[model samples]
Target: MKSAAKATPAEDSAETSTQLIRDSIRVAIVERRLSPGTKLSENDVGNLFNVSRTLARAALQALSYEGLVSVAKNRGAFVAYPSPDEARQIFAARRLVEPGILREAAARITPDDISQLKQLLLEEGRLMSERGQTARRAEIKASGDFHLRLAEISGNAIMQRFMEELVARSSLVIALYGQSTVSSCGHSEHGDIIAAIEGDDLDRACRLMLHHIAHIEADLDLRERKSLGLKEAFEL
Candidate 1:
């Protein structure tokens, strides 16, 4: 079967509509564009990206699979509002998954992977250095790209898919309960992880990955949700 994914053109060619939908929502969540409980209407998303509702459904379903959004029987879809316990579980899962990926990558990461990872870091650092913690396109792009790059090194498509999903959900959790919008995910830890991996210290690389995820969990305020309108903004 052909995958639900279909490639696009130039800038769009690199990402399919489903991936686009997944990423758009992910960005909105990470950058505080969509807060917890934000309603996502199908028609809205279809219009924003100029796609059919069919494609939008695919995107939303992909996110639901990742636990970033909830699609109710009759209520349509809304951003996930993870309970504190659920939040803890998410981080715990990340601690295991990410560290394993780091350790495996350290064992087999190629020079090209290192080069790409470094390039990605440069983009991430640039995003963080911007004047404001703006939800600029580049910032969102970098956030997702970081996970994609790591998954590339991990060399397992299924688990890598899980990481991508987890990363998206992590963004949702951050948007909802984040303590400060300044830095939802630490901007510098990737380099530390890379350095450890490059030095062939698998233990240290694993530790660094664990610590990085812990820092993200620490950023969550866990109090309650705020109102950001990805739904209303793009009508999606």
Candidate 2:
């Protein structure tokens, strides 16, 4: 196999900085530290990271494209607040995509992959059991990461990228419409899907995956939009 190409020092540094900024904001959003519709000023981000406005702008632009942030002409950026209709559409798209991914993963997954997934599930369970704002936030992020890991195991780079975007958008949807106490995707349900995959039961895995997605979508209280504010948004 051919070796992967290495980035030059300057390129690596730039990529690392961009990724750091992106991840910081993404994690904040996933943890609900940044609430939906909260304005994200470039200067605020730059100050938070001790980075340049240009880098902050690039990070915000990237997030906007991921559907986690919305940008308006001269209005600056804000965390995306998915409408009920948009929330429905996001879940509908996930239903279309995730089952097939699980099926493929079931067929192709190795023993090590299953082990890793079990470990993640364990960690998720641990986080869920802990009581605190930090534990709750970690659990939320872990729940979304589970689906992203499934996509990664499907061994499709394109699908992996698609799921990454979908999961991020789903975070926004959950922030806006999900009931406060309901787990985004229940840890038990995730375990069931993983069990099916481990057994190499493609049909069962796909079915469980669909059910899992539906269950999450069903938990949403989409009748009314959640109110937003910068104070709630910026708190970590």
Candidate 3:
């Protein structure tokens, strides 16, 4: 058997730059810094990130595959504006899977995992108190990270990937529809779920998981809103 060829330095650089752009855009979307329907012009993105248009296009295309960006013919790329029905579907999927994921995570969770979860909860609560767009964005990301971390602890690779999509989509939905200034996932609720899991109460943990997801769904207004300007939305 022949060994696989390695990527040259130039190829590695391009891939790194592309991934960096993609991740920056993804974080902006997921953290609600960028609103739905905001245009992501390749030229602007290239200039913003100091990369070529080709690299920017690649980044946008990558986000499109993740259901976080929409690329239309002749319309350019925009942050995904999920419809009300799509929002319902996103929560529906999360409600269907998160309880199971929570249970599996509980089954496999170690002491270190529990400690890490507690630490995340602490950080999340601290962020909630701080005032600033940057802190708010970090808080939102940390809230989503709680669920994503649970999926990671489940020891199911496929479920982990699915949860990633669901969480990202959920962020978009909440960004457009959420009535509260804070994320729909409550700070106390995360702590409660962790407590249940620590106490070996899988049933309560699952129920709490469902309720947590439901709280997010219940907070949605689900009406259309005008898009924020890219410069203001991204604070560029």
Q: Considering every candidate listed, which one attains the maximal TM-score?
A: 2
- Candidate 1, residues 123-220, lDDT tens digits: the string is 88877777654645457557666766776576777777787777776766665567775543666777887888888888887888788878878888
* Deviation in Å, model 1, residue 84 alpha carbon: 1.9
Residue pairs with colliding backbones in model 2 are none
Which one wins on lDDT?
3
User: Can you tell me which runs of candidate 2 are displaced by over 4 Å?
Assistant: 1-14, 224-236
The best-first sequence of candidates by TM-score reads 2, 3, 1
Candidate with the larger TM-score of 1 and 3:
3
Cα lDDT, all candidates = 0.73, 0.84, 0.88
RMSD of each: 7.4, 5.7, 7.4
Report the C-alpha displacement of residue 211, candidate 3, in angstroms: 0.7
Per-prediction TM-score to the true structure, in the order listed = 0.77, 0.87, 0.86
Q: Write down the TM-score for model 3.
A: 0.86
